[model samples]
Target: MRVGPVGVLVRPRAGVAGLVVAVALLGVAGVAVFSGSLDIAPARVLAALAGDGTRVETLVVVDRRLARTLAAVLVGFALGCAGALTQSITRNPIASPDILGVTTGAGFFAVLLITHPALLPGGSAMLAAAAITGGLVTTGGILALSWRAGFDGLRLILVGISVNAIGMAGVSWLLLRTDIDQAAVAMRWLTGSLSGARMPDVLLLAPFVLAAGLACAYLARDLAALRLGRSVAPALGTAPGRTEALALLVAVVLASGATAVAGPVAFAAFVAPQAAMRLFGTAGPPPLAGGLTGALLILAADLTAQRLPAELPVGVVTAVVGAPFLLYLLHRHRRRTSV
Candidate 1:
């Protein structure tokens, strides 16, 4: 597609790159399934996948590790899509689930509720619902705080930063006060590990991700219209107010559902869309490409975290990757302003 000043054909090149990324992601998933801190041969991995492996290998590869890998992919896709939606609606490059305080808020409630295991409902279903609620509530609060007769991107970012700081502080307090077992659970949630994900997490997140993804696709045309600015978009029949609200709601669902599954994964949301935009050389956030970018990043990061001797948290790994990218973005912004 010819987007903006660039008359680039997105079809031929983007398709091949996307396929390559997909294949690479599948290979990573296979690696996660077949290998752990200890490596497994490909033949044995295939046997384990085919259900012909020894009991120990089956339980180790197919049962535990694959589940975690799948969770990482799905969670990454959800958060990446959420980041795209938020950026499109806000017309801000830095908007993300973490920056908007949505994930932190969901994480706060999740940590609190999970602390009292008995207080949580019997399954991941209930946990997912509670987490989604937390995300929505926080997003709603940020929206309200940022609303001063009109939405301003700078104000929104500020409010989000403050809200996130407060939520994280609350999480820290909960962690410090809780018992060792509960604290351990809280720690995983904080660091964002997919270690013990079951099918329940997948089932809970998949439907929301699919639905919201479709919703984003439907709004893509409208979102493009909004790029013309406040006056032009409304004149063109894109109700700026309603569109912004819808976009925010969709973003909230995506972020919340993902957070429900894997805790608040850091940087995937921010970095994925940015990476996708650069890859595609597109003006607007590329939802499909962004999701794929996120899936690749998270899968690679999760695998690295698992393979590391220390077993570092996946979120930490993402932060390590994203911090430099963030600095680059700031540098670019400064250069642009100077020019």
Candidate 2:
């Protein structure tokens, strides 16, 4: 559709990709709902979902499985959207909460308070606040350190990797000094399991996820402008600096929300956006598609963890997939730069 003097092209690639991802997510979630310890049959599970089954079946499917599924979706979306924001700002495929120490910093603070809850008065909620604060502060420091060179993508990634290492070291050192039970709890949380997800947990996370995602969506236009080049943003009447700063902040908040709920489930942030950008044929990652892809990734990983013979955290399954992808990305980048 176009006027006499202009032309318009409409593409629904992302819309289609998102639909496929959504369908896959539903299928995986259905399997997850039916595969837990109780082993309810599919027909009974469907009846329970429809509110026609016995009380125990209803409690098993609707109460536990459904809530856990919702939590997985929310956490995955938050991390995936956050990844898109960071990558857009830096124009770097691997720039994510995981690589930037945002998640590690949040996880460190969370585990610190977890191991020493006597130091904090507000219970798990307080720990969540600490995690978010840690990510914010960590990102602020990284920005300051990397700002010296005008937000170079390589510099940001390199500095972030260093900080991430230190944060991980801190977490390890803390775990070493703590009691076994506290360490055990922290370890499980760090592994990113949906085992403990509850309806209240989903409720606690939804608002922050929605808020940060909306902020990212609002910045999308500005982000599109920045993609032309940092210098071009000013000529186009956009403040690249401010746009980037705010985007990073919002992204950290998003990642922190997920980390608070799911313990930084590694590489969903790193993997989802790159996958979405390639699959949707976007110049950059589309936040909404990236988020939907992430939700599917986590849900499917959770489903896989459920079917495993041994009890495994969802993060374990994610890392198994993500680590290889990360290596491939690094190898590709290395080859490109070398050329």
Output the number of the lDDT-best candidate.
2
Candidate 1 lDDT by residue in tens digits, 153-222: 6788889999999999998998888899889877887787787777667777778878887887778767
| Least accurate 10 contiguous residues by lDDT in model 1 | 6-15
User: Candidate 2 has which clashing residue pairs, if any?
Assistant: none
Which candidate has the top score in TM-score?
Answer: 2
- TM-score per prediction, in order, is 0.90, 0.91
Can you write out model 2's per-residue Cα lDDT over 1-339, one digit (the tens) per residue? Answer: 479985534368766776788888888877778768897898999999899999999889988999899999999888888899889888988799899999999999899899998778886678779899989988887878887757777788889999999999999999999999999999999998888888877888899888877786678778888999898988888899889888888889889878988897988999999888888788897777788888999988987887799979999999999999989988988999999
Where in model 1 is the C-alpha error above 4 Å?
1-13, 37-44, 51-55
RMSD of 2: 3.2
Q: What overall lDDT, based on C-alpha atoms, would model 1 receive against the true structure?
A: 0.83
lDDT accuracy of residue 116 in candidate 2: 90
Give lDDT per model, in order.
0.83, 0.87
Number of colliding residue pairs in each model: 0, 0
- RMSD (Cα, Å) for all candidates, in order, is 3.6, 3.2
